[model samples]
Target: MASEGSTPQQLSDDFTDLQKKLQVVIEARQRLDAQLSENQAVQKEFAELDDDANIYKLIGPTLIKQDKDEAVMNVDKRLDFIDKEIKRIEAQIAEYSENSEKKKAEIMRLQMEQQQQQQQQQQGPA
Candidate 1:
């Protein structure tokens, strides 16, 4: 039966899928890092500004005057959201990395088994 012998193709496919998922998570984390850096810079700039400093927000090509406190609050909110997202993405990366390692081990085991089987058959009656 086909079940008597495991196919490497299936294991390869699973490993590839795991790799792709891991890559996607890594890319997402990179984007989040960039966003976090940018938001932190904005927050720092806001901290250094005078309370009465003019704050303008770009809204559909128009600069709308915004309160300094409000701008600071908005940046804080963005930083919080980004921090949460980074944590979530980090968890995903760990999971994917673990799965990928398992899949690779499984593939190696299957290859070893297949090699042993071929050797036995080639040796004929022993």
Candidate 2:
């Protein structure tokens, strides 16, 4: 129920806005997933390195020599950060999905109500 007089057009617009918000959340989740994958790969590579192996980090357009221990610590931190971000974004996606479904059902109900009212009006008084 949209209070006194909401009209069908207003309900339609609300549905559109809800769908757009859901789409934005879905896109953000996709980007975060890709970033999480990349960071996991980097973490795996660092974990597989030998203690005596020379390591270089790409800073700007140059490869800077980095200590093996420091590189390992840095990658571990990055993995943790990416994991947290992915979880947060996934939570947002779930919320948006639930909201979208509820909004869709509301829109359908509103449409059906509008059709019934119009039919009654066309039939005039009984």
Candidate 3:
């Protein structure tokens, strides 16, 4: 629904707008991926620790002691949330990509038609 315009200029504008949106979605997906990786690393570290091992979290430049089980649970929740966000963004990216492709094809078709019209005009009375 984002790229319904049919005019050459309108189609070009829609394509540009979709590209910008795609870039933003990609950036967001990248950030979510980084967070997911970090959370997974933390989970791995937790797995390697003893049940009685001390766990600390940095809070505003201060080391705050946190229960290992609670920390693991929090990290698990964060990973799940990040995964969902990534999936949502990926869907948006796919939609935007499809729409952009359509707009590009329309623009090319319009250009070719214009060229054909010009050729016909030049050959007038011949």
Q: TM-scores for all candidates?
A: 0.93, 0.83, 0.92
> What 10-residue stretch in candidate 1 is worst by lDDT?
1-10
Q: Candidate 1 lDDT, tens digit per residue, 3-111?
A: 3354789778878998999999999999999999999999999999999999999999899999999999999999999999999999999999998898888888888
Which one wins by TM-score: 2 or 3?
3
In TM-score terms, candidate 1 sits at 0.93
Clashing pairs in 2: none
Cα lDDT tens digits for candidate 3, 1-126: 434446777777888999999999999999998898889999999999999999999999999999989999999999989989998999999999999898788888889999999999999967
lDDT, candidates in the order shown: 0.91, 0.79, 0.89
**Residue 73 lDDT (model 1):** 97
Candidate 1 overall lDDT versus native:
0.91
* Clash-forming residue pairs, model 3: none
Off by over 4 Å in 2: 1-5
Q: Is candidate 2 or candidate 3 better by lDDT?
A: 3
Query: Could you tell me the lDDT of residue 51 within candidate 2?
Result: 86
Q: Give candidate 2's whole-model lDDT.
A: 0.79
